[model samples]
Target: MTSLFRPDVEALAGYTPGEQPQESGWVKLNTNENPYPPSPQVVAAIKQALEGRLNVYPDPLGRKFCQAAADVYGVDPDWILPANGSDENLTILVRAFADKNDLIAYPYPSYVLYETLAEIQGTRRARLQLNGDWSWDLQRNRPLIEQAKLLFLPNPNSPSGNSWSLDCIQKLVPPNGVLVHDEAYGDFAANPHRMELLRSEVGSQVVVTKTLSKSYSLAGLRFGFCIAQPDMIRGMRKVKDSYNCDMIALAAAEAALLDQDWMLANRNKILNTRAQLASELSESGFDVVPSDANFVWATHPVLKHQTIYEELKARKVLIRFMQFPGGIEPCDRYPDGKLDGLRITVGTDEEIQSLLKTLRVVIEDSPST
Candidate 1:
């Protein structure tokens, strides 16, 4: 077959998402989706929206949804830019800000999508390796940050499941580039909001990306929004699709925001489950990261991570496993070594218990244990 794709596309190994199991009996924990269902009000709103609105083209600007989001976040409507999901917002951000040869800085092993975005845009990526403790290395990134056009950073980072404080973020600000903060898991974290950081002295360069996917349990609906200066928001809107968000998604997301208590209740459940999961993993000789999100990153000190990952898969329990430090395939052998455990999502009570049982048998049987 004659290949027509660009050299960059030909060489790139694209992002791999969490496994979706066809087997019904398996306990899945790979992706960090909300375990519980969305609010009844959200369901009702979506259904109601489906009645007569399907025929008409939705609002290109998505003003109604923007207003709802702004109301909840306490930001002006002009500052809220709604997208199909946070991923869409991020892609647009890179396209709008970064040029072909321009660079973007981000923490390595943070969000896999950031790398994908950088590559697709043909922009250089300055990946700052996280310290042994999984914290950002600001010193290493200082030089790259100065020249980069955009920086994609995830707060309470995925896979690692740890958060950087507002003070920490303040100190990491790049002198000239735009800082796009991915707060997909911020709802579950202890912080009230990162919007305040943008209001500070360095307000111009920061944009906070949020999603209804995690806390509101609206992953299927694909609703997310970003908060930035009005000018930045305008730039994003200009680049986004005219009808990026559908009527049902807009209506449902609005309902979800309105029922704040419902979202809080679901978040509390996950937080409790995350605590229990982390505590159990720690006691069982796994070094579990202190998670502020809906999942925990647990690594067994002695066991090879690949071995544990394979054991879990063989047991029909799915979880996320990354090849550490610039590696592409999840199964690629780690010559330099990577974390040797799993990124387990905090599922419901019964599901978590099932995982613990299998984990106990697997860990105790390992030579390290």
Candidate 2:
């Protein structure tokens, strides 16, 4: 029988999201979701939206959400493009800018979705490897940067939980290509590279994408937006789904934006927890990467990565063990080594304490390095 799918789709592997275990009583910290609940304003606004509008389609352009984002970010509403989520924004970007023959460039071991999107579009990709220290080196990556039509750079990049400096970013700005500064975890970092230079006369080539998932504690809400020049926003809007954002999401996001103080309070707590987790893991003989995101990426000196991951899972404390063969470079691989890298999301203080206690026991039970 002949396959009906595109050849690229047939051969490509889909993105694997973090496991969401159904069973209760498990310490779920594998996914980078905020442990705290969303603001009261969000809940109230959602309830209000439910009471009035279920039959009508939401504003196709998400005017209110764009306005709210504009006010918060100090941009004109025409510069904001709201989406179902940041993931949708990624899709829109791929469709809006790149053709099947164009090259899409992104850092390897960053976001897996960028590669998947390119594959779906049947576009070629230039997977640039990070330096041994997991930082971007512009001189080394100039070839890929020059060839790319669309470039995705994630600040406080995922899996590694480290960031590229603004100076590093400036060197990679393409002379005639689109640069997407994916800032999904920017709020957690102290000095996130916002690419505010794009807002200046030299910024027409860049777009900064953000989400309500992490800092705002609204992962389930599925709301995100991008900031760019009005021309870029208009181009993306033309390629987006007719009614990308629903009424409930719009109301909830607007309310959440209005109550940024509540979100900031929760952000501070998560930052504090992240600091403590990193410190504790470092003291426990793990080579913990200093993270600017809400999670800590660490590798143990002795234990095999899979062994520790299984032990934690069996003990009902779930954390992410990254083992992407050709995607993310394993931090713990030796001549004959087990895949070794852990990305642990920072939870509430009580949950962090529980995780620390369980981790200590797991390490103690294992053989010494």
lDDT of each: 0.82, 0.85
lDDT of 2 at 363: 84
- Flag clash pairs in model 2: 198-203
The numbered model that scores best in TM-score is 2
Please provide, for model 2 over 69-176, each residue's C-alpha lDDT reduced to its tens digit, 9 standing for 90 to 100.
Answer: 888888889999988889999999999999988999998777888998998998989888775567776777898898889999998898888878776777777766
TM-score of each: 0.93, 0.95
Worst 10 residues of 2 by lDDT: 328-337
lDDT tens digits, residues 290-317, model 1?
Answer: 9989999887667866777778789988
**Cα lDDT, model 1, residue 361:** 82
